[model samples]
Target: MRLRRRTFLQGTAAATAAGLYAPAVLAQAKFKVAGIHASPVENAWNSRLHGAMQEAAAEGKIDYVFSEGVSGTDYGRAMRDYCEQGVDLVVGEAYAVESEAREIAGQYPDVGFLMGSSSGPAGENFGTFGTWNHEAAYLAGMLAAPMSQSGVFGAVGAIPIPEVNMLINGFRAGVTRVRPDAKHLIGFIGTFFDPPKAREAGLAQIDAGADILFGERIGTADAAKERGIKAIGSLIDYTPRYPETVFANAMWYFSPLLMAAVADKQAGTPTGRDYTPYCLMKEGGNDIEFAPDMVPEDAIGPMEEVRAAIKAGTFEVPVDMSEPT
Candidate 1:
C-alpha cells in the first residue's frame, strides 16, 4: 500500500491522538513503551517500528510514546528521559551512539532496551535487532530479473552498512540467479533520508543502461516513475505511492519484534538477547509485496514456491554483508 509521510506520527501527541495508547485491561496498563528515533517517523525503517507500536497501543497491549529527529548526541538523553518517565520498554536505533545507548541501559537495569544496531547483546536490559529481510529482497530480485530489458539493474541505498548491504547483495544474487550475465549498477546516497540524492543516483544509473532499479532509498520510485522503468522497493511497501512503477517490495514487519519485546517485559525478564531471529521470514518479520499488474503471470507460481521454501525452512536466503559496488 501507499504510505503517506505526512500522516506519520511524531511522539506523544501523535500516539494519543491516534488512540494508540489506551490500556486494554486494567492489568495491562502497567506496561509503558517508548521509541526514540534518530530519523523522522516517515522514514521507512522508523515507520515500521512506529506502525508496530501503534498496533500494540490500539490493542491496549502497551502505552506507547515516541520521539523523532533524535540525534546521536541526544539519543542517550532521550532514552534516559523515557526511562525517567517510568517507561518499561525503550526502543531505538543505536548505530551512531552504540556505547552511549548501552551505557544508558546499564544505568537503568529494570527498563528494557531494544535497539537496531550492528552490535550484539550488551547488559542485562539491552539488546539489538536488525531488519534481516534479505530473503524478501532476494525474492524481489528474482522478480526484477526477468522484467529488466537492459540486462542491467540499478540500486540506490541509504548507506553501505551491513543492513543495507545485505539487502543489496540479496537482490544482486537474485538478479544473477535468473540472468546469469546481468550487470548491477549500485550507488549509496550516504544519508538515510535524502530523496533528492537517491533520485539523482537513480537517474545516473538509468542513463548508464539500467532498465530496472532496486529502490532501497526513498526517491528511487520517483526516478523510475519519471523514466517509465520497473522498480523493486525495500523496507516498506511503496505500491500505494508508485502503483504504476513499483511492482514488488521487500517489507520488514517490526511487529513481531515489538511483540516479543513486550512479552519479555511483561514476564519480568530482561530483553538482553539478539532478537534478529524474530525478524526472519519464518517469524513473520519479513515478506515480499507484489503488484500483480506489473508481475508476469508466468513468474507467480515460482515466486510462491520460493516463499514457501523459506517459510518451511527448506531453503535459506544467504546473508551477504559485503558491500555492493
Candidate 2:
C-alpha cells in the first residue's frame, strides 16, 4: 500500500487507540527527516530508502533532505552534520561504519537515528532496520525450482554478508522444496553496483548449464536476458526491464519501516531497538511478485500456499548466514 500522510496518520491514531502511545502523540506527526546514504540513489538498497523518504515528504509527513554517495570514512561526519543542522530524524545504512555511526548517534540524544546495521541498535537514540528478505527469497526459490530448464540454477550476489547469504540460502532451500535434485551455482561479485562483474559471473554460471539465475546484484539480469533464460529479482522489481526474462522477484518495501520509525519518533519511543519487525513478511516489509506468463501455471498455486503459510505463521523460513559454496 502507498503510505500517504493520511493513511500513516490514521495508522498512528489507531495504534494510539490500542494504547501503544498516548493520544497526545498525534500532535508530533510532522518530523524533519534527513538521510545519509552510503550508496548512490540508483543503487537498489539506497534507492529503497530514498524512494520511501521521498514519498513521505510528498505526503507532508517529513521535510526530507538527503546526501548520497557518502563514503564509509565520512559517514560519521555526514551524520553529525545532519544532527548539528537540527534534523529530528537521521536515516541511513551503517553496515560499513557501524561502530563509528553508532558513536556519532550517541552524541545526539534528541535526534532519532535509524540506521541499517548488521547488529541491533546502540545508545538511547540509535535504532536500526534491514531488508530482512530471506523468506521472500525462499518464496522466489520455490517458483524458480520448477521453472529451471537445465536442473541447475545460479545466484549472483554482491557480497558474502549475512544479509546476502540468507537470501542465497533461502533461495536454495526453496529450490530444494520442489526440485530436491536441483544444483546451485553461486557467485559473489564483491561489490553491489558492478554490473559488468556480475554479468561475467552470471555468464560463467550459464556456461556451466545453469538456466535460471538469481540477480541479487543489478547486472545478473543482463546475463539472463542474453541467455534468454528466466531470472529472479531482488530488493525491487525488475520485470519492467526484463519482462520476458524475469519471472519472480523478492521485493523489500521500505515504506513500512520508515513509517514505523516516524510513529516511534512521534510517540517519543524511537530508540535503542531493532525495527526489523517492520521488515518481516508479516508486516508487509518483504514480498514476492510472480509474472503470470513466465511462471509455470502449476507452480503458482503451491507458491501462493507457501506465501499464505508464511503470513499465517504456520511455516517459518529459517535464516542461514553461512556463506554459500
Candidate 3:
C-alpha cells in the first residue's frame, strides 16, 4: 500500500483527528502510540509499520502518530521527542542507532519501544524484531526457480544484514530444491532505498545471463520491466504496480508484532522480548503472494502444498543467516 508521508506531529495536539486523546474516551482511553520511521512511510519496510499503525488507529485502539523520512543521525532525537510527548509506545528501527536508542529507552522505562533490530531486546522497554519473511521468500523461490531459463537468478538487496541474508538464503534454498543446478548472482547496493542502484544491479545481472531477478530492493523490477523478464518482489507486493514483471512477492505484515506490544503496554507488562516469532507464517506476520496465471502449472501445486505444510507446522523453512556471495 502506498502511504502518504506524514510529517512529525508537533505540539500537544499530536493525536490524530479522532485519536484516543479526545474526551470521547477519556474514561477508557487506549494507549498512545507513536511511530518514528527512518525511511519514507511508502518504503517496503516502513510501509508495514505505517499500515499497521493506520489499521490500529482506524480501530480506535490508540492515539497514533508518526514521523517519516527521519535520518539515522536524527533517530535519537525523534525517539526522545516522542517519549517526552508522553507516548506510551514508540516504534521504529534501531539498526543504525542501537546504542543511542537503547540509552533513550533506558531513560524512559515506561514507554514500550518496539524496534526493527538485528539484536535482542535491551532493558525493560526496548523490544526488537527482524524482518522474518523467509518462509514466504522460500515459497517465492520454489515458484520462481522454474521460470529461469538460464538456470541463473539474480538477487538485488540493500545490504547483507542478518534479516536480508536470511531471506535471500531461504529463497536460494528453495531455488535449489526445485532446480539442483540452478545458480545465482547477488548484489548489495549498501543503502536501503536507492532504486536506481538496485535497478543497475539487476540490469547487470540480467546481462550476466540471469533470467529472473529477486527484487529485494525497489528498483529491480524496473530492470525486469525494461528487459521484459520475470521478477519476485520483497516485503510488499509490487505485482499491482509491475503487473507484467513481478509475478510473486514475499509479503510482511507488521500488525501481529505491534499488537502484541500494544497488548503488553495495556496490561502493564514489559514488551522487552524478541518479536521475531510473531512474524512467522503461523502468526500471520509473513506470507507469499503470487499471480496464479503467472505461476507455471507444474509449480503451483507444490508451492501451495508447501505453504500449507508451513502453516500446519509440519514443514519448517530453514533459516540461514550467512551472507550470499
Which candidate gets the maximum lDDT versus the true structure?
Answer: 3
lDDT of 1 by residue, 179-248 (tens): 8999999998888778998999999999999989999999998999999998889989999999899999
Query: Which rank order by lDDT, best down to worst?
Result: 3, 1, 2
Q: Model 1 compared with the native: what TM-score?
A: 0.90
> Would you give me the overall lDDT of model 3?
0.90
Instruction: Give the alpha carbon lDDT tens digit for every residue of 1-325 in model 2.
Output: 7799999999888986764342124324457889998888888888989999999999988878899999998888899887776778899988899888888888898889888999888888899986788889999999889887789999999889888998899999999999999999999888877899999999999999999999899889999999889899999899998888888899998888888887888789856788988888988999998788877889889989999999998999988989999
Q: In model 1, how large is the Cα lDDT of residue 67?
A: 98
User: Per-residue CA lDDT of candidate 3, range 102-193, in tens?
Assistant: 99999999789999887889988899998899999999999998898899999999989888999999899989999999998999999987
Could you tell me every candidate's TM-score relative to the true structure? 0.90, 0.89, 0.91
Model 2 quality (TM-score): 0.89
Ten consecutive residues with minimal summed lDDT in candidate 3?
3-12
Ranking by TM-score: 3, 1, 2
Task: For model 1, give the RMSD to the true fold.
Answer: 7.6
